[model samples]
Target: MSAPPLSLRWRRRDEPLPAVAVAASGAVVTQLGADALMRVTAGAHLRACVGREQSWLVVLGDEADLPWADGAVYLGWDGGLLVPTLAQPWPCADLLREPLRRLTKQQTGLIALLPELVLAGPLPREPLDPARLAPS
Candidate 1:
């Protein structure tokens, strides 16, 4: 099957990740683009991307902040697309993975969000408080 047409909708810095309902096409979003939506930072600019059948909500940030987890796929700075092993049933993540990869690969500008050199950048660390990480 052909992949759904890709578009981006930027979320406000204070806005939380789009919920499952939004990804299910139950909600309406107006904006659309193929560019880097917003900068993501650990302190002030927390961002997330939610992809449904049509649009993707993405935040551009330091490549280091993105963990190469089970379901997470990283688009490279060299315009290479890396596919992750489908280890689990992450329906929403799976649905958008390839499309997001394609978008990032084609639009190499998104990779520019990460700095060529980061001086003592924050390493990817686990949260000290696990309770806050739990779902509300």
Candidate 2:
């Protein structure tokens, strides 16, 4: 079967830009145990799985492309960062049932899912720049 078409959405043109630290890397590490996120510089594979109200991040050496499909929504992207759009009302239980996966390079990493509560913090802050985030 064919895969669903990937759709992307950018932040409003008037919104402020995101921080450089969070928007400068493609490969990011999810410190699930620590309740924090870290950006990595090496890795060939990217995997994101959801369960209960939490999302899991996995990296491997196998090369792959960004896993995108229907129903998936991306928040923003800068010259270096990409954010995932999660469902509403804090923890998105819906994503836990249907997870997403992608094979991407370190320069093209993945930001699987971000809960609403997390969004209130300082992680993702702007829409992605399609021109800069697109594969070159």
Candidate 3:
């Protein structure tokens, strides 16, 4: 009964970012940490640490422009990790209700989120098999 692995795409500033699969509501939470889920509240940008040194930042605000297609979520690089910038405003209460998906790309690593910030336990020993999770 463990949470599914989170798929991540590491892109440089010049590369074309992956498109995030979002619903009409324009809100989606990608599992991008080892044991933590980063929720992008309507106007809030939170960074969740993954594993030991790596971290994923979820940015959502009125100024961000997130491109949306029929069934894909796109992310942009902020000189570091992949970031999905949501242009629309999503209520925190509603974001909490949305089901978190294993955000995956063609060939990338996987991660997830934990509830507590102090709980920095080691990631699962097993390496993620991208074949198991759905592609983003």
| Model 2: ten consecutive residues of lowest lDDT | 32-41
Question: Each candidate: what lDDT?
Answer: 0.27, 0.27, 0.27
> Cα deviation of 133 in candidate 1 (Å)?
13
Compute the lDDT for candidate 2.
0.27
Could you tell me which 10 consecutive residues in candidate 1 have the lowest summed lDDT?
112-121
Off by over 4 Å in 3: 1-71, 75-84, 93-126, 133-136
Q: Specify the poorest-scoring 10-residue window by lDDT in model 3.
A: 110-119
- TM-score for each model: 0.23, 0.22, 0.18
Candidate 2 residue-wise lDDT, 22-99, digit = tens: 211122222221111121223213323222233322221112223322333333333223343222222232332222
Best by TM-score: 1
> Model 3 misses residue 77 by how many Å?
13
lDDT of 3 by residue, 36-71 (tens): 121232322333222222222222222233322343
